[model samples]
Target chain A: MNVTVKTFAQLREITQEGCFTLTLPESAVTMGDVITLLKSRSDKWSQALGASAGSENGSVLMARNQQLCDIQTHVQPGDELAFFPPVTGG
Target chain B: MFALIGDADFDQQWLYNRLRQEASQKAKGNVGAIVTFTGLVRDNNADGNILGIELEHYPGMTEQALTNLVQEAITRFSLTSAGAVHRVGRLYNDEQIVWVGTAAPHRAAAFEGANFLMDMLKQSVPLWKKEFTRDNSRWVEVKASDDKAALAWLREK
Candidate 1:
């Protein structure tokens, strides 16, 4: 299955790419799996998406198909996933 | 009238006029109060003078979130109408960053509704801000005060 992954704001700065496609195995059914896969690609990916260092300031926010979700949230093929920093605009 | 505008300046007066027109149409002259709030980009943050700031948002989600917030404010406060406009992309200091307007039968409802919109917007919206200083730039950290304000609304219920 292929999923479209997006990074924004500071995460984008760290990742150096705003959007990309990731191929996942059938066993990888959740956002956590996607994070784990991306984190393994490189230290930068780990630093940006890792659960511990998530971002410089705080935990990264995740959205599946533009709706806010958690790592445990189930994902499917062709889903759009986003990771970004905490919101500050008003 | 909820929108996530990019780099384009918005007219607060137009939003106010629209709210007034909507109030008159929806309530038949019953609305007695209309309130609006505008957020400006400050020239400085805790670090010192800021040259400007860049705002980024998740495109599709941002629009849906603002629309949902406006609808929620209207339903919760029994407002006649409400609108919110947020700016994205590079913005200079003192520029208008956001605007929110609400109309209701009384002053209290209108005031509370506008307040609710801003408080909720800070916490729930997907937009992020980055401050650019003369020598450096950094992402604005989420303030605990903002969380407290947003939570106060929930506690009020």
Candidate 2:
């Protein structure tokens, strides 16, 4: 399965990569699994995605198919997943 | 409901008239009030010595989210029409950043609808603002005050 992953704002700066594709294994069930996978890939990704800062669960916001979702949300094969910081615009 | 996500400054008179026209066409001059709010780029934030700001947004996601907000405002406040226009890209101080307007048969709903749109927009919209000073730039973090404002609306329902 494949997923389109995107990062924005400070999250993009931390990841050093804005958008990309991720190939997920059959074992992957939810968005949290994908984040865990990315965190395991490299040090930069781990640090940027909030995994290392101990703010991974709450501070970071996630969206599936462009709508806000929880990490526990189920994933389809080609879902678009985005990670971003809390919004600050009016 | 209407929403526009662009870099150009929006015309306030046009928005008001458009909303009024839409509502009148729907139900013969029933719109009694139209509340409009415009957010401008101030010269200062927490750091006093600010130059300008740059706004970033999720192109497709932003439009969808804003459209949903406009629709929600119209329904939640019993508004006849609702709309918003958010500016993006590099903006200088004293420039317009955003606009939200709501129309209803009464003044109370119009005012409340506009307020709800703004409060929700500050937190839920996928828009990020970066402040620029003489030395450097930094992303503006979400404020607890904004969350409180939006939460108040939700709890009332």
Candidate 3:
């Protein structure tokens, strides 16, 4: 299964791209798994993903298909997943 | 009322011209004053460092919030037409951050309408600001002053 993850703000800088697609196995998955996978890819993800000390609980907001979602939400193939820091705009 | 998700810069001249055109199109009634408010990004914060600012918003929620605010303003004050545009992404110091333009038959109405748009936008809009300093970055939190301003409007209504 492939998921296209959209990154914004701090996450975008860490990923160095607006969005990227990743293949996940057809097994049970959670936000924690995604973070672990992302961290394994590079130190940037490890730091920005909150695997590093002093990071804000990863504070990365999650949205599945444009609607805000919790970390436990079930994700399927082709799902549009997004990660972003706390939004600050007016 | 209009909202957009893009990096387009605001042209004051063009906006003023459009507002005049729309006002005429609406009616030639004794409309007196047009009130406009523009928000810009500043370089300094409490930390006293100079840098840029970044704005982020919830896509769907942002449009919905602005629409509701415009409707509320119209109900509060008999406005002809009110519009606002907010910029997203990284912004340099002194860049136009947001704008609110209101047209009404009287100064009071136009003034109230423009104020309503800005006050409500700061309080209710699901947008956030991040201040970038030379040494560090911080999320701009909603201030008590904003709450007081928004509350004052509600009290008057």
Candidate 4:
């Protein structure tokens, strides 16, 4: 399956890629799987998507099909996934 | 009504008047109060004096999230009307960054409606802010106080 991944704000700055298409195997069916694949691509990817340096909280936020979701959420073919920082707008 | 504007300033008076007009028409002129809030970019943060800031948002999700917020406020507070406009992209200090207006038959509802809108907006909106100072720039961290404020509403129920 092909999923479109989007990174925003500091995540975008760190990864240096705004949007891209990722090819995932049928076994990689969850957002966690997607993160696992991306984190292995490079050190920048790992730092951007991995848990915070010294904190338990995940450094990045995730969304599936534009709605906020967690790593356990399922992802299907053609889904749009987004990764960003915690919201800070008023 | 809700909008995600970019690189442009919105007319506060225009939105206020529009809300009043719509609320009066919808509620048969029973609207007794209209409340509005405008957020401006401060010139400084804890790091130092902020030269400016840039805002980014997930395009489709941003609109949906803001609209949901306004609708939730209307239902929760019995507001006749509610609207919000947020600016994105590059913005200078002291500039208007956001505007929210609410109208109701009483002052209390209007006041609380606008407050609820702002509180919820801070927590759920997908927009992110990056502040630029003289020597460095950093993404604004989410405030625990904001989460507390939003949760306070849930506890009220």
Q: What DockQ does each prediction reach against the true complex?
A: 0.48, 0.53, 0.15, 0.50
Q: What is the TM-score of chain A alone in each candidate?
A: 0.88, 0.89, 0.82, 0.90
lDDT of 4 at A90: 74
Best by lDDT: 2
Evaluate all candidate structures by whole-model CA lDDT and list the values in order. Answer: 0.82, 0.84, 0.69, 0.82
Task: Please give, for residues B1-157, the per-residue lDDT of candidate 2 as tens digits.
Answer: 7899999888889988888788887767688888999999999986586888999999898898889888889988999998999999999999999999898999999999999999899977889999999899999977655544433432332
Please identify which of the two predictions, 3 or 4, would achieve the higher TM-score against the true structure. 4
Which digits, one per residue and each the tens of the lDDT, describe model 3 over residues A1-90? 889877766667667967788888656386556666777778777777674311223355566665545566677788887766654455
How would you encode candidate 1's per-residue C-alpha lDDT over B1-157 as one tens digit per residue? 4555567988888888887887888898698899999999989887689999989988988887788788889999999999999999999988999999999989999999999899899887778998998788899888755544433432333
lDDT of 4 by residue, A1-90 (tens): 899999999889999989999999878988888888889888999988876421225456777898767677899999999888778897
Q: Write the per-residue lDDT of candidate 1 for residues A1-90, one digit (tens) a residue.
A: 998999899889888879999899888998888888888977878888766532223457777897776667799889999887768888
TM-score of each: 0.91, 0.92, 0.62, 0.91
Q: Is the docking of candidate 1 incorrect, acceptable, medium or high quality?
A: acceptable
lDDT of 4 by residue, B27-133 (tens): 97698899999999999998678988888988888888788788889998999999999999989999999999998999999999989888788887888899988
In model 3, how large is the Cα lDDT of residue B27? 62
Score candidate 1 by DockQ: 0.48
What is the alpha-carbon lDDT of model 3 when measured against the actual structure?
A: 0.69
